[model samples]
Target: MSTTAIGINAAIAVGAYFMTVRMIPRLRDMFIKANLAGRDLCKKDKPQIPESYGVLIGCVFLISMFLFIPIPFAFDEAAATDALTGGKPATFPHDKFVELIAALLSICCMIFLGFADDVLDLRWRHKLLLPTIATLPLLMVYYVNYNSTTVMMPNFARGVFGTSVNIGVLYYIFMGKLAVFCTNAINILAGINGLEVGQSLIIAASVTVFNFIELALGHQVESHQFSLHFMLPFLATSLALWKFNRYPSQVFVGDTYCYFAGMTFAVVGILGHFSKTLLLFFLPQILNFLYSTPQLFHFVPCPRHRLPKYDAKTDLLHISTTEFRLNELGKLGRLMVTLLRSMRLISWQELEDGRVITNNFTLINFVLFIFGPVHERVITQMLMGFQIICTLLALFIRYPLANYFYATET
Candidate 1:
């Protein structure tokens, strides 16, 4: 089978998976009005339909297999040429069968997990166990066909490990541990409504950009053969899932979808031979997590807990305690103050004592943003720019924008 056929097939399968998942909410509503015994199945005061929605979605993906599997595969000659000529074009693996199998396993695992989580509310232990078991075949396939050398300081210092090592016992242990970490990280981020979906967009965009860079470098064979095959399909699946996952979310992706998506990404990074690049793709989220770590450890207070939970939904760790505690001011006044505090335009103590504290924490993030990547590469520069923009926007824009929409209602 050709690379083009595989790419097209994967796209269709993912598209179908998302389209079907989107129907869950509507189905739930119907079930609830009917006074079904399963009304309790939906947890959020919102009705939940049967696990049949998952089955249906899985079926759509299954049908795509028949549609895509048979077409004669052909590589994208144009993409190959572009890559060789130092122009970026998205490319896929020459061996379509391996990718096809990986995608199929991914879809199936997602459907299974989605159904279980939606109906049963599976425990954390079980969630870990199930995905770990499912990830083995994928790990095997990845090791069999891909290189596992740790490439540090690309095009410079590098360590080459034989394919024999990749196929050995030790590689499986490392892959298993990495898979669990990534999948859980995605699940943790999926805790809030719209957060996972929003973050996924950023990740997908980054990966797509990386793929474009690889293509432009005219090294399509190296990039596409080992890496993009998995990444592209994973990105495609996430994009399709986002349709159902956006605000006023119709269907929660549940553990199933999140786990599958995370595994796909984790495996792709491992195979791509670009662990460092994967870190770059996830930079924003990593920073956010780090910023929040102090609060998690009780080193600092989280102000959102002091406010009405719904109204305080967007509060990050950086938000000050004073603004969070102020209730005498009207909602609009409170919003303006909170906005200022979040941006680090004003200190929490200043808002509390009616005087600004001279020192602040905002600059710490700014400095890290500038120096983080330790390189002058285009991607690093762009990321640094994003950090600055995010800092400014968080301080100056997001609050006002949020206030405009939520003031009266909250």
Candidate 2:
């Protein structure tokens, strides 16, 4: 029965992939006609491309899931028996279905908010809080379902906080913050062609692998199955989008894709009961966020767009820098800069006068700095490679090294 359901979902995913591909070009002109377009700033020609077309991906994904709603019931022999014999009517996974509906509602809200952001160009602070509103349905579902609020503690910390600590309301708070973080994480680490979509694809693929592993182990099969159902369609739509959004891109995914993609991962992670494991897959994004904290918090000057500086003459991208005067740095700021430079996390240059220039705090810029100037496509491939490496390390830590930290395999 599980195999049948998986086969059906796989078939639906294939259809969604083709649907996304076919609809993009047709919708491109419509998007442009609606004045939803942007120039590819990194390109030499700066071609005008349709933007905010991620609505197509979101719509197709939702429709695909809706079509799949009846598959599980069709395959459920117990439910079929119950219906015929008028036995227990509760044979169906009605609770799981409710959770699915709530998850879809939250995702739908995020898609609407993303499209609104694309159209209205929402402020940064507003974007930070917007995902919280979208996450309310998910939180409410979790509350009503009475999901576990206890978290496992490491062996070393067990002596201090016990083996597992239940934080109750704080767990919900953490989940809400997680939704906000996941929604914004992809948006902040983006620039260049394919980088956003590419990284997101890597994370989605990683999560899918994790789900499959858990399912195969017969560990929390239902949760992993739910995660897989959401991830397969998402992966299909994202892969289709990547084909057009790659280097020398024919279209831009815009902020809509970022929010939608982030929320997709968030939903699967939160509802799948593996939020902690999901975070392990986001190591790169977390590092990037930490690296950009000073700039993000306005301790240092930040530009509206900190994308790599494109050199049309060289036809390559180089590390973009932020200028700071010697006097502008407080003692702590100067110490932090020096520490980062020493750790080789950032490259710093001191001017003849009293000014300093350092590579902007972004994974993209850091890669460019480390590798020197390279073509946009090359840099994107490098970062994708980095993302893959990080995810692998995360899995290793989650499975193998986890035994050392916890009393048992986590």
lDDT of each: 0.48, 0.87
Best-performing candidate as measured by lDDT: 2
**Candidate 1 deviant stretches above 4 angstroms:** 1-66, 70-96, 146-171, 220-244, 287-308, 312-410
- Tens digits of per-residue lDDT, candidate 1, 233-344, equal 4455455555554544555555555555566566566555444455556555466445444333333333333211122232222221322235444565455556655775
* Residues 29-72, model 2: lDDT tens digits: 89999999999888888899998877888999999999988886
Off by over 4 Å in 2: 81-87, 329-332, 407-410
lDDT of 2 at 214: 86
Clashing pairs in 2: none
TM-score of 2: 0.95
Model 1: which residue pairs collide? 2-73, 2-74, 83-218, 87-216, 88-215, 88-216, 343-395, 350-355
lDDT score at residue 368, model 1, on the 0-100 scale = 30
